[model samples]
Target: MAELNINGNRRMLIGKVVSDKADKTIVVLVETLVKHPLYKKYIRRRTKFMAHDPANDCKIGDKVQIVEFRPLSRRKRWHLDKILEKAV
Candidate 1:
């Protein structure tokens, strides 16, 4: 059998920190657009994700990047990778 080459699995998301609560968990809000099939009108949608911030460096209104990792808690399956940009 040939050895299988497994690629590392990670997820990256750019969003704004909606909340920073718990010990090291922050909520990120990701906005996206969906277009109607017939009308082609775009609709705005938002999703919230719980990400782990070990350093507690993220704050509300700050834009950041998050990556997937081993589950840190019941809802935290992602961790803060970096702060891409800060909110003005």
Candidate 2:
């Protein structure tokens, strides 16, 4: 829900960096609250996204912003926009 706009209509998402072991790639975990159809209760849903990190400046637990972009690999469709906060 903290999405931002940059470079036109591409989608943007905010998430936490869960993995940064890959050479120039980072795995971001985006979580959202979804309401159940019948239960009317909110459920935490998580999605992992492979994002391109050209500078490899991210680390695990870092909050980062990512924007949708052309696929760089079979699974990489997002690029690092900026780091929101650094992990302590």
Candidate 3:
């Protein structure tokens, strides 16, 4: 038998950290696309995710990578993985 890795199927996203508050919660903005039904064109969309910041090192406008995890709070289901770029 093989062990099922449920938690290991985490999702990773690259975005910018928009906010850090409430002790260890951070907000990340991820930009993606949505296909237009009629025109068949892709539209850009921005999504905000509330994630757990265990180390609390992220800041506003800082590019970061986040991964999906078990809910840390009522809203937080993602965790900070690493900072890809710093805010200027």
Candidate 4:
């Protein structure tokens, strides 16, 4: 199985839940700030991750932590670790 690093530690990411309509699955929008190589200006980049949420505890707008894992589905390679902040 593909692992995050040589240390066998899974990669962790923080993101906000964008969708939770699927059963036991939640879509998270992880945003990162990247600096342009030539311009040196930071720009916002966003990626959507299909994460497994066995408990179905996440709701839209909730901030959560996800950990990389073995493939749970065709596009799901991450699992919800914790709900960092409840939707408010």
Task: List the pairs of residues colliding in candidate 4.
Answer: none
lDDT of 2 by residue, 1-88 (tens): 3454565788889999999999999999998888999999999888999999999999999999999989899999999989999999
- Distance from true position, residue 56, model 2, in Å? 0.7
Best by lDDT: 2
TM-score of 4: 0.90
RMSD, every candidate, angstroms: 7.8, 1.9, 6.6, 4.5
Let me know the TM-score candidate 2 reaches against the reference structure: 0.91
lDDT of each: 0.80, 0.91, 0.80, 0.87
lDDT of 4 at 75: 97
Clashing pairs in 3: none
Using TM-score as the measure, the top candidate is: 2
Q: Write the per-residue lDDT of candidate 4 for residues 25-49, one digit (tens) a residue.
A: 9999988888999999988888999
TM-score of 1: 0.82
**Number of clashing residue pairs, candidate 3:** 0
- Lowest summed lDDT across 10 adjacent residues in model 1 is found at 1-10
Residue lDDT tens for model 1, 1-88: 0111233767577788989977788998877778989999988778888999888888889988887778777888878989987777
- What's the lDDT for residue 53 in model 3? 83
- lDDT ranking, high to low: 2, 4, 3, 1
